[model samples]
Target chain A: MSETPTPDGSPSTWSEDRLHRWLAEQSWPATLAGSRGHDAAVLETFAGRPVLCTDQCIEGVHFELGAGGRAAGRKAVLRTLSDLAATAAVPFAVTLGVMAPRSIEGVPLEAWLRAAITGAHDAATEHGAELVAGDLAMVEGPIALAVTALGHTSSGTVPVGRDRAQPGQLVLLSGPVGGSLPSDRHLEPLPRIEAGVAIAAAGATAMMDVSDGLAWDLYRLARASGVTVRLETERIQPHPDAEDAAASSGRTPLDHGLHDGEDHELIATIAAEDWAAFRREGAASGWHVIGTVEAMDRSAGHLQLRSPEGHSAWLPGAGRGWDYGGGE
Target chain B: MSETPTPDGSPSTWSEDRLHRWLAEQSWPATLAGSRGHDAAVLETFAGRPVLCTDQCIEGVHFELGAGGRAAGRKAVLRTLSDLAATAAVPFAVTLGVMAPRSIEGVPLEAWLRAAITGAHDAATEHGAELVAGDLAMVEGPIALAVTALGHTSSGTVPVGRDRAQPGQLVLLSGPVGGSLPSDRHLEPLPRIEAGVAIAAAGATAMMDVSDGLAWDLYRLARASGVTVRLETERIQPHPDAEDAAASSGRTPLDHGLHDGEDHELIATIAAEDWAAFRREGAASGWHVIGTVEAMDRSAGHLQLRSPEGHSAWLPGAGRGWDYGGGE
Candidate 1:
């Protein structure tokens, strides 16, 4: 047996044990053990239900080396953490699977692996989660990373799903959206974990993270909940960078707000009667009311945008955005 | 904004939704939901410690497409499930992250994805685990699959770890090991979950799955447990295919048994006093005593093989086997 050639035509010399030891040295939660040097990791789950999610970050797909390995690693973990936030679950532990190329940007594969692990560790620690276990493989392919986030429901709470919205519920966004790519917000945006828990506690109905643009994700929510979501165009607030992006790209800020993906913000639907209390508590967190749920009308489309002048238009391809095969 | 070209110089046309619908149609446990089109999957833990592990199957590194996508998929899940067996943890659910190439074996990307998902579902369901959540990404690289297996301890049972072995304990194997690669046994070996639980219940001190050859994996167990393991060469039983492999390759069956990786068999250390009882109950399941653990001697090797003629030799490069970068 000999060393395999990497995609960049370099020899792969990193051993699996070398990578395992690097991961074991990182700070992990006390509840995580039996992972390093063992077959699997053991973790203690709280008395509530468990929430699990997995997301992948592929080079030249989710990111390129030009953005740095740290950003790619952080985005991998953040994507899964965003799902935990949408479910209103408390973070527990994460296991990473990395398929590394031989070399990245003139740096050895070891450096790239270290940077990625460090970024994942920092992000997990910041979110009260632990990096418990990981596996690494070198291949003659683009670098790819997979993060599996495990979480649990807190006491007296239940995980929120995307199919629980009811008619007459108001749709809300945790913060501004759009222009995420230009601002690098997709890699650094905060997961609304606390806000998600607060909303779930105050009786929010359906909820999800807006990773694939507001128009696409909202339509998914509407379809899952069997309801129609009508957005008030005048009430939408674009991210601060949206105007600059729109000016340079010949598109309106509203267009970017509706089409730009990877915002990593939480969105939920709250009953009209519960909106007052939710708003009173969530105002400091930048929760904004943007739309309302109504009875489904197949002719009107699942998602519709209405202007202040009383003109309504269907959002074309409302549930389509940023697919991996169809690159962004 | 357009479909990207795959590594094999073909266009990727598989959509995330198309793969999701295919997975959702598979037979899964009743408890798995909110996974097909949701951000995260929610599962109920059975009031026990949770076991988590992630393993990767990269195309070219783990298996080439020449082996077929179904074999690749089955191997991916089986690898993680083998870890679960080593821990004696009852499996609950599995989440698959697939990064697909444009095409495989002259088939469309969608066909490759469907075959892989179907194979994963079949293997997981056969082992009494649900295929709960999955993420699909089409990348300009070789196919990569990551299987994150989540399991839980049954009531009154605890997860077995590699650090619990003690000096004077006997080492045992679940079945013969050798010539796995040539026989294609590496891709389809049975994971010894029931046998592992039995051994644990009968008081196994330490345990691990023998994936990277008996010599390498035994050394790992010894190092983790702070002991030295000695094996009897005359007592070692090679698999039925090992003789043919050795005859064709001009090596001894013992050589193959010592170095051939990916056996997927369970190896455990048990107290000498408990061995009799374990053997009485586990013999029907093919458990065989193979060696003994002793105090570590830095001057000597962690693993030593002794022949009946009073000759001994240290296994060369113990714990170094089948690294992805090194190429097996």
Candidate 2:
């Protein structure tokens, strides 16, 4: 087999030194300090509270070569950004861990890496964050990108955590879900930073971004908060692509909305009284009241779906969504 | 063609859900908040300054299966900790990204994962940090582990960084270098956290961990600080195993000291006047004066060594060490 070509069209393998040189050439956030060649990147925090999270996007698992290296890079950083949004935190810096393949679809390894870094840089810039530090390795298999995003909340604001949802609260969905896969919405869903911050400021009791299917994530919220959640099936709006996805997958649009993964919409629980003020905040997307939080009952299940007919049943596929290691 | 077996001796793929469940059972740092099932682990920072770094250890690249999964895991975390030490930052939390192979030797996959996690956890604990978050995926190639370490500096102490070395500074090494491979010192070199902090406090201007070979890394420091470095060959001290490494490889112990990578020793530059004070501070193992910084002369090379006979020449193998992609 022929050797892989570097981005410079040379036969030399992509070295750590080359990677560092490329990173140094990029413009980082003003908050970043210290030289680029140091062992670590240092950042000064304005808000004392540091919000940190890590996420990985792997080939054949999170994305495929067909998705393009740019999308892969965007999704890797975006996934972690969504987590920061869940906590109502403002991102400041990110450190990337990239394991690159020898070649990507006959393209030079360097070209693929450049595309990936550009994608990450663009996404981070758009979200008010910067690529501060990163590590690169050459792997014999598919590419894997891991991102750790460091963020902070405003001085007096505490992060909205998943275990604080209270009973007698209104459940809100930032936007439509389901059928995200068919529309490729999973590749580039906007992280709900604005909506999350508004909702949190409006007294959101608890919140989380919906990554794995709506039902599965809701179940998680319920378990964490020691409460049960009831979703009104008819009130749940499917994405515009749900119809097409349902047609191809032999499932209803509502089913796709409930089970499809990577929606990246924010799901939050707020006091019933705060709902009006939250709505008046004028979040980019109008909120949808899809459910309510109730006292937990072990025998009744932690999560249920209420049909328009007033009948309720435990959500189907209680904890199923996309499984990286295959079987649900 | 058969399915890989988990460390638990079960014929199961390493699922994200399973990994989460496993993580939930472990004890995290007290500062860690939010539910275990959340998208990211949230940390409350005691120090306002955040230090971040990322490092990856890949099978066949950083280590082989013959070295054992535990050693691989330890080395991955150790590498990042070394970076933290170089900066004189105290590590608070770390997130792990692991891509497991279909099979590891004849051992079950689950067993291998268990060993790796145990190793990482032990290492983190030894350094007063915790594994707060992690991601795991299955790959068709060798296992890869990426670790992002988050740290902090005390209230008024600034992190030691590169690019501060002055032209008239003394270069110091915390310990010997070379021959880390056969002796397996690379797998478990003690990160000089205390030493680094003391050195930084005592007025070291520039510092870095020697992961790459001494000559190669010194060249990096020279380039970054905009000065040339001169090493006194007679003063260079090789590790105890360097002689054996030289015997087996048909090279001189000094060659191994200057070229073999994975030393993980701290190298620093201090003002000539501070050298006496630095020595008075009683740094562990004391410091070795290996070289001095001088005005940069592009034509004369960035790094050179002065022999005992009063002869000086540029170091051999300019930028040669361990190459991840292939041949050095």
Candidate 3:
């Protein structure tokens, strides 16, 4: 904010001019060049139906304060992209809003800010989206980052919704889940963008991202669809991190798999006939059949967890990686 | 976020179901219904070149933490819309990211949050746009809000930019400016969306909204266009609020008119011949021909303030609507 720089080149002294200069040097997408030098970015019409989603991360809320800038930024961008993945949409563009603190664990604020932006920008670019607009401000508080991703379903393909699951449908997960937060795996989530599109293309009827734990998110999906999700506990795959975390947590790895947040994995429900086609085509290769959809009257709650020994329990509404009451 | 309601039915305890129910009842645009009931909002292809812009407001940074909730929301939405106005883009949709503080001036956090969202939602709707997507979070610090607006230039109209002013072009201001912050006028800025379109349609070469003071914005336009703006100091329109403040501030109203922030007025540069057409068509009504654009080498600075007697001085970079020693 000042022209005078500190001897160590602290970022607190990064002027607006320096900020602009840094911005001008980013590897902006070629298609966006025409939109440069303006108050807004101009782009052509989006393909198919335009999808819009916004996600924000706050220090101490979503992540710890000063917990690595690049990690924070990646989490923000990837989580936003995960929302689009829930709908099987193609990434088109993104916009970011940053409210940063003056100091962060003694790291130059500029360096943190730049690393955060680079992380966000790189993640977006890698996922086929371009950063088109951004707004930055330095405030007297914890760092907060917000990202909006504008995307679209492929032509002729309508976006999938959580409310479309049928009672006779099968539920699947793109990969293993759990122990994301304790393992610091939430920081650099691997969004299942392509897998989501493939699953949708394979005729999945309903889908969502497991960002707020499998138990809670499945509850949401089942409630939306007016059906129950009977998660087959024995069939579910818990990540190695979940197993590692279970050692000291006094809970099984399956508990972590069922309740950990920020997995960024896709959970889709499709009819048996559709699943057969999807499997034959190898689209469901690494994906697991973790559950089945059922009528609400057949379960105690919207989401029912069933064990291999014929044991069953209704999970709680809010879930953490550790046990929260519903266990076999 | 509890299901149990207080004796007085406080909003702070409003549950997630209540939030969703509140959202479902909003007067969402008919066009966006396809995007509803999902993690994201979707819409058909935008009308022309798509315009993307983001803006944010933070409590204690942009305004007082307890400032009227509705006013704060309006300011955020209106300011973001102003960027679209600068590019002559028609409003299409908006997505909001809210990081809310628990208690605000004793108003139930829910009430404040609702009022804020209502303010933003209403503003966007009134301007031919829709609030299509939104994300909300409860945080520990100051309430920080972010809004991303997606818009489009009218069909066949390329978005106007800051870097197109040419020599012999006439500079114009949409209306009176200054004293916005002191007068609380910044809280409800009337974006020049329609006028910006008219100017761009009238063949104006360059345009921008006078947000960060006419002086600084003009300097930006000049620098971007690689031209110098010659201001005719007497021709500017000082708002009555500026005049009212000047009486007690001991500075001329024009000083405030020249340097006040958040004016949200449109500034346009047109060739004299084109200006004639704009005037003949009644498009120049209530607009002032404030200056002339000249080659950069023709002036001492990117923006040159010229008096009736030909006395002038180069203005400072960051303007505060106060004297910074550039007075002639």
Candidate 4:
């Protein structure tokens, strides 16, 4: 999140009513948020075929509020945009549902809220999406956010999906993964939207975002596509943060790349024939050819790691990078 | 929300993993919420002018969990749909961001979550909107929800906005308001989409929802439109629920009608000449002509209560029926 100026007039007193009035006086997305008269936000005109996605980020569940509201809002929006990237949808607009606690890190609510809303607004603005929504709840619980992103699929390109991978297809990773949590890198997920659009344009068959560790997410894609994905272990490389943390964690950097979650990398699949043309456009440069899709053994798991030493079918949850269901 | 049967196989061994697996096996909006394959929900095609709105419902803040998950879910979706109704937009889709605490009302997390999902699904289906989105957070905090409702404006009818009211226009209320909290009538807000559409077709100048009590919301509309709304006290009628609660409470039924919150009714304005044509279509029935729009004093509040005895300008927060920002 950008370190902009502190909110003007942090409010004489910290009250939800005053916070709302303060929000209205500011120059954010007044059409939807902070305005009392607008019952619901209306986009006067948008005639494209749209795709919608929503995601949640809760303090104490997804991340701590130590970094404050700007980071919180940024992460929430980036995650939603990440989902849109996974779908290869062109980002258009973003909306938020915020449930905020009375205070943030002992600071009054208004300052933090202003920063958070600015964070979301700036992020959406940077990515060509408008931040709009009129929902704000003053809760006594942890700060929770629900971000909904809406977009359109690029013309002539079908939305890349998760269950269309076919046997003999190659799997691609948008970038390196690992150590996002330990290094606090997860807070800055780059939306791989351009990569996704290119992949779809290249006639990619399927795609998924690597929010959960590559191992578990790949397994999900394989199972969904009814195919087995065999990872080329030697080809997988650890991100710089992964290597930086590997020294003290007593684990290999590659281990983190395979199991660490929240990297927000794009995972796409395409026929071997398309691989050459997919890279012809330099925009697809960072993507790594990591694995190949194969026929799945109906009775076994649909994921495998093929190292020089050997290969074996991997089971779900055996090495899950992150399981939100497994309470904090 | 419809009271469907309890979720299947409440997962013998309760765990987030099991909950997820069981959820995937169900027949909800698998394309979004309950599925693992789709990275994001996609409407393959949607070609209309879109209007988007989002709202939040946090347990202990918005409603209590005593009624269980179904009621909670129903109220959340209904609130969102009500916002769309206020905007004069047709409902198309709904998405959720849920932050659930474990063991709602002594029930296991899975059962409550299942019922909650079904509640949202059924409510959206009943309103001609599809419920889709893949975002759920399990927190130890209150069950907080963020619902985003999307739809399009009907062709030929301009979206009834908040800043178009003119002096000498008539202010209309879609239905009765007040005592929603005490009567538990807030749990079932009827979407006034058809009424709003009809009102807009009748060339309504401004619109807002009565989520924040009639006095406050009308003042907001007046401020936005730079006009004053002079309400005729005799013309306003308290809802049956409001009267029922007024018998026990010291306040008058008219007071409750003017101040009570959570009655998701539509407040619209139209030129006095348009009233005849507005009612020409039967769909506009049930709308009450409660007030008239006049030039604002600029110094005083933009709302007034006029009765047989006297007329006085109403302050914004004076005798507020409800203040969400004021915590319980």
True contacts kept of each: 0.63, 0.60, 0.53, 0.64
lDDT tens digits, residues B1-328, model 4? 1222335534322245555565567665644421343767777455446788898887876678776778888888988988888877888888877777644444555677667777887888888887777467777778777889988877766666777788989999988878898888887778888887788878887888898898888887887788888999899878988898899998899889988888889999998778877676556677879999988775545888889999888876555734566521
Local accuracy of candidate 1 as per-residue lDDT tens digits, A1-328: 3655566654445656766655556556456645355788877656667788899988786787777778888988988898889988877888899887655545556656778877887898899988777788877778888999988777666556787778888998888889988877777768788888788888887899998888878877887777888988878898887887998999889889877888878889888767798667644376778999989977667787888767454553423354554432
Clashing pairs in 4: none
- In model 3, which runs have C-alpha deviations exceeding 4 angstroms? A1-7, A13-17, A27-29, A311-328, B1-8, B11-18, B25-29, B33-37, B317-328
The candidate that wins on lDDT is: 3
User: Each prediction's Cα lDDT score?
Assistant: 0.78, 0.78, 0.79, 0.77
lDDT of 2 by residue, A177-216 (tens): 8888778878897878888777878888788999888888
CAPRI-style quality class for the chain A–B interface of candidate 1: medium
DockQ comparisons of all candidates to the true complex: 0.51, 0.53, 0.46, 0.49
The order by descending DockQ is 2, 1, 4, 3
Just chain B of model 3: what TM-score? 0.90
Model 2 lDDT tens row, B80-127: 999988987888888788888655556666656767877887788899
Docking class of 3: acceptable
- Candidate 1 residue B157 Cα shift, in angstroms, is 3.6
Candidate 4 docking classification:
medium
Question: Of the pair 1 and 2, which is ahead by lDDT?
Answer: 2
lDDT per residue as tens, model 1, B134-199:
788877688888999988766566567887778898888888889998988777868788888788
Clash pairs, model 1 backbone: none
